[model samples]
Target: MLQTLKLLLPALIPSWRFFDWIAPSPRIEIKVNNDWQEFRPRPDHVSFPTMMKRMVWNPYVNENLFLASCAERLVDNPADQHSYEQILNRILADINDQKVTSLQFRLAFIHREGNALKKDIRYVSKIHDVSGAQA
Candidate 1:
């Protein structure tokens, strides 16, 4: 998936800033593939990075979040898997019917002392702009 993304990123993204975890308020990462390329657009085969138990994501993260995140990115941006994960999760919330579930941004309250899972949510609607977060 990472290799595919690098190949397809340039066309789908009008302009993008790479994201990083260090060195700045919002870190920017460089694309692994060379600068300009076109996406092949194969939603069926795109794969996600394995979720780690000690990762920063919520406690109840599951395959739904993983797969939906991919589908969600196809609609918005098909190139960046990281961006797809973040944006796709939010949009996936909206995809569910209104009567069944409300679009509400899910939150986890981790205590400073223990970092335990205090809450679990399946929906999120308060997010106004998920512009920069690339997973």
Candidate 2:
């Protein structure tokens, strides 16, 4: 009975170990007009009301989170074509400019080193023609 109770105790109690080990996360960057930018850039400043609203309903934020998950998958499996295609489709959908004819994408691992953040480029895809490609 004591052994059974000990086994069940852990199940009943919650372990709030959220940050046991901090590691780098993968980020998707798209090259647009000779400049590379984050696929989904977060706003620098969000108001208290806006933060509360986003916590309740924010499709864009959710989509970005999904994309981040896909990026992590890509990092784990470099030959993951499904995740690669999903990221490409997302980038194509976001860029609706007529002037941009070609673009490239790369996966970057972002991590905090000491007090500074650093980005290390992992994979750089060949330039893709946007004119003939379908998202």
lDDT of each: 0.36, 0.84
* Per-residue lDDT over 34-97 for candidate 1, one digit per residue giving the tens place of the 0 to 100 score: 2211112224542355344326664334443454444344434435557545643544444333
> Candidate 2: lDDT over CA atoms?
0.84
Candidate 2 at 127: error in angstroms? 1.8
TM-score of each: 0.20, 0.77
In model 1, which regions exceed 4 Å deviation? 1-95, 100-102, 112-135
RMSD of each: 17.1, 7.4
Candidate 2, which segments miss by more than 4 Å at Cα? Answer: 1-18, 133-135
lDDT of 2 by residue, 1-135 (tens): 998999799779969787799878778898888999887778899899998998889998888888888888887888989888888888888886546789899989989999999999988877988876543
Q: Assess candidate 1 and give its lDDT.
A: 0.36
